[model samples]
Target: MMRTSLDQGTSDVSDQQGGVRTRTRAAIDAPHLRTDRWWLAPAATAAGLLAFIVYSTWRAFANADYYAAPYVSPFYSPCLAENCDAMRAGPNWDLFGGWWGISPAIIILIFPLGFRLTCYYYRKAYYRGFWASPPACAVAEPHKKYTGETRFPLVLQNIHRYFFYAAIVVAGILTYDTVLAFRDEHYEWGHMGLGTLVFLVNIVLIWAYTISCHSCRHIVGGKLKHFSRHPVRYRMWQWVGKLNARHMLLAWASLVSVALADFYVYLVASGAFDDPRLF
Candidate 1:
């Protein structure tokens, strides 16, 4: 009888507490164990985001050398203003013409930038990386009360779904840019080069990232009750879920691709390097 009682007692530690599990502190606290290298992720994220900001800001203001034959910097595409470049690539909206010497990218980057800034994953990332709001798991935030997304600026995050629509249009524009990259300086078909490949890969990354967005996934799948009745959305939902699973990977990949695409165009336009023709 004692042996059976001991075996039962040993097996059910959780039941001893009467189906309740509680930590009595009444406040969130870090673990007692040593935290090793907990700061590295946030530090690295800060460095990368800062570097991209500085470089992008410099390139945005540089204005010149953003266009080479058959290759325009991703940062400067849809160069909507007059005096942009000889390529005359886009619609030439020209709303801001040399006014304070702002680059077209200054005007154009807002939508796409807004999309990423309000992204759900990015919210978590920068919340930890930049804001250091609890920096990592089991860490404490600097603030006493957690305001979350209820405040003024955070309230604006609700517009991410709207931004997703605009981003799809922007992706279409980028796809056109990729098509243009396929042509040579003379606009002949059957032309391929390192720049072409770069643009191609960049657009693919952008599409993957954009398509796999949390907003995109929810729009495709959420609110559906009967999957059998909606076979198409169900299929799309399934595929997007697969991509969404790797959304973080796609986010960083697309970021790097954009920077590199712009840099490649910069090199060609500035006469720093030639785009090797693979045709």
Candidate 2:
């Protein structure tokens, strides 16, 4: 996919204030230095992202303590593997073989992982935070060569639209998992607890993040020529646009909420704590 600079227009502007003329240029000269707290933001972002990756990877590989009665880790939901905990098993496909009980999360997280990895906001965040592709505003990047997302593995990012579609299906499945949380071990309805609340919040945040995706917005409205003719589409697009404005917030919030949801289930299943019941 071709990339265009969002900060393209109005690169140079002149302002007169306090009887002084000052001019600002958008593009900075290479190898420049400005003494400021430039590295802090990117460093913090990298730390947060790296921590999440490490934690999620550990949980994904973990085969135990992902389920309790009426509560399942979000990471291990839609459990396709046999030998999963009896309470957490979801449509077990008898996947893998004896001597190997793989976690379903290992297989299922790829789609949502790809969706987040290739997100527009995340691209900018990581490109600056991890890769240091100009680490921060007015800072020179570490790489001597810059090919951008045009070559080889970077080109794979073009498939993000497809990943967006996959994310929608995953969101649906997770939503269903939340609905299932309403039942107890005996399949009796109206069961409620801390885990149920966690799952409910997790699904809502995931839906918010997924539905507010730029790709979703584009798919819903990109080809339309007239907002006048397609009032319904236009209204939906408008709402999506409003959501898209806060996509980055939803993205991070959903990530944290989902991880918290999984960790909550893990703790309960592991007997670290008892899941308090409300009804």
Candidate 3:
């Protein structure tokens, strides 16, 4: 119970159920009383995310050094233009024709980018890192009023479910790319190199991140009234739930792995160094 006195600028607060103890709270007008540095997490998050954005945007536009004989950058996988003659990873997926002169990665990256942009985790991350909406706990946001995702650009987050479907297709393509990475520079099967190991790790992290998505969890587990009736879905849902718990960790791991994988291919394709054969 709180009894406020306008004249005294204090409140008589009962600290116990039976009013056995009473304490007065003299209001402090400061925004928050936190004494420690609370901005470090958001600052680091902004730095990491911003660094990735700069690197990815630059690489997406570069368009060169994204493919070597048997390895292709994840950014340019499923390259879909006639110009992708040497760069093409799998079968001739010249879906976009030769008229498209820009980077093939431009066509391929949109789906996965969309999936991550609208991801529930990324949204929360950028919301604090970039926007600083109440940046940390007990902190007051700068805005005078709060208008959530009810408006224009933010409202587009509702399409996350659609992006989830596109991500599944992209993951499948990357998986195919990872399989191709097992070959040597001469395209011989049963060969493994450092690049092959990189590709394998990248693909595993990507799948882990995708399968651990909240949308995946809902798709496999939600909308079921009786778990006893559907044994298969129940089992799958249990599996997804386990991964979902580590979704954030997987998200960061996959993000770094993809960039590193692409960088490795770039180094090899650019003739900076040959992908060292491991086996």
For lDDT, the strongest prediction is 3
Runs of candidate 2 with Cα error greater than 4 angstroms are 1-30, 88-101
Which lDDT tens digits does candidate 3 get at residues 3-110? 664553333454221211214333433445577899898898889999999999999989889888788888987888877747434634889998999888899899
Query: What TM-score would every model get versus the actual structure?
Result: 0.86, 0.85, 0.88
Looking at candidate 2, the ten consecutive residues that score lowest on lDDT are: 15-24
lDDT of 2: 0.81
Once fitted onto the true fold, the runs of candidate 1 whose alpha carbons sit more than 4 angstroms away are 1-34, 88-91, 95-101
List, residue by residue over 1-279, the lDDT tens digit for candidate 1.
Answer: 344533211333332321111233322222222348988988888888788889888998888888888888878767766667767354245656655356777777887889999988788889999997868876655665678889998899999999999899888888888888888988777799999999999999999999999999889975588889999999999999999999988988998899999999889988999989999
Give the CA lDDT, 0 to 100, for residue 143 in model 3. Answer: 62
For model 2, what is the alpha-carbon lDDT of residue 212? 94
lDDT scores in order: 0.80, 0.81, 0.83
lDDT score for residue 206 of model 1: 97
Best by TM-score: 3
Q: What order do you get sorting by lDDT, best first?
A: 3, 2, 1
TM-score of 1: 0.86
* Higher-ranked by TM-score: 2 or 3: 3
lDDT of 3: 0.83
Error of model 2, residue 100, in angstroms? 6.2
